[model samples]
Target: MSTYLPVSGWCYMTNDLMKEIIRVAVEAGERIMKIYEGDIRIEHKEDSSPLTEADRRSHEHIVSELKKITPEIPVLSEESADISWQKRKSWGKYWLVDPLDGTKEFIKKNGEFTVNIALIKENALAAGVVVIPAQKLIYRADINNGAFRRNYDGAETKLTADNNLNTDNLKIVGSRSHQSELMQTFVSNFENYEIVAAGSSLKFCLLAEGKADVYPRFGPTSEWDTAAGQCVLECAGGVVLDNAGNKLQYNTKDSVLNPYFIGMREYNEAVLSWFKALN
Candidate 1:
């Protein structure tokens, strides 16, 4: 029920949208910053993780402002918009967003939380934008068009993935705040690699910007969690593939839980075969 548009050049339009979207994301980040610094109360989600007023405020701002920017575009955000299976099945294109990622890190006051916004067209993520509120840094991408990193005070620089992961020279970036056992097992299988920890969607940024080389996730993740970051990484010449060595697709499953996947900087015959064996 959806149509695929040729992935052609559309930099001007995408950048314009990014400018507007950046405005909203930065504003929402400011809103969250205020709560983070003030005497705001932190609650827990139904799953019993820490949820603060900052999360709610940021979510509200992102959803309301994004709707104003693109009214026709449907949104699938972490805090809001739980689309039914029937309804989601009909969405050819949509905005897959997470206003406040790393709420636990936000609660920890480590200043690692980020605001994630992504555009999903067809089954793939078309664009990814990540803003670090405390640092005022931004990571953005529109594949074929380009991907770059910038900060409030810094100039933009192009992002590119490094093909330097081969045994001893390997670098593995794990969840900053949450690492699972399966992930550790998978990483241990590698002959030689240094492991790094990062929070929120920043792990994807590290891979995209060439800071880290590989990311393995054998635990549970949702569609909204990985959509934006995956787009950015893919644009930067990285790949986010499932067990079958295929890129993950959205809205096709009844449950939004993502299967195990690995994000790597470029393709490697050895690693690909290794993962296929793990499959």
Candidate 2:
């Protein structure tokens, strides 16, 4: 593997490197699945989120493998995110990972959890790989390359977002665990839309593959939670926008928490106006 310099852009993300990252994510997912099948023990984080042995095992495996693959680049995983802002502020390029997203759903045995890994270049998502362990699905994307969905059998399909937005009957995807009043208000604006409830980063994959048209996230989320999925959606001709209607970015602040954002198959001015009117 070639050593990548901490450059300003995504020039270092080659197809081979993307493949290696995908392999790492898939292996991490395999580790998680082993725990998922057995008697599970769950712990609670200080923030009250569910933590499991699978998260720890996956985090350790991914961090160790990523170091071997790109020793020069730094990695920041949700499991080991104790690095100070002073240290993180200077990182022009780094790996952002969420070993197990939708842990609540994982505990529910709903098969909606995911492993998310993303490359951040100059505070923007350069590449990402998301693996659904139970479903044996992979979604990957890069800044230059388009998005793809790969099956366990190695069959791959190029993903394209459904750019058409039907106001009368929209296909909207929402969080299965974190529904809030703000999200309700946003959805209420559309009189005839159907809800497509999903957990973790699968909502983004749904938009990437044209299965859903929009995802309105009104509740709180961390940077790791959205980065990989956002990359996949954006590379598939979609947009994940912050409240200000700008592209959602990463690592630009002290907190890892993300602001309220919307994920759509494509940029729609009317939708933006509707979201803005809510505020």
RMSD for all candidates, in order, please.
4.4, 2.2
Clashing pairs in 1: 176-198
What digit string (tens of lDDT, one per residue) describes model 1 on residues 132-203? Answer: 999999988876566788997689998888566676677888765555756666676777778788888888
Best by lDDT: 2
User: What are the clash counts of all predictions, listed in order?
Assistant: 1, 0
| TM-score, structure 2 vs. true | 0.95
TM-score of each: 0.90, 0.95
What lDDT tens digits, residue by residue, belong to model 2 across residues 62-154? Answer: 999888888778999999999999999999889999999999889989999999999998899889999999999999998787899988778
lDDT for model 2 comes to 0.89
Give Cα-based local distance difference scores for all models.
Answer: 0.79, 0.89
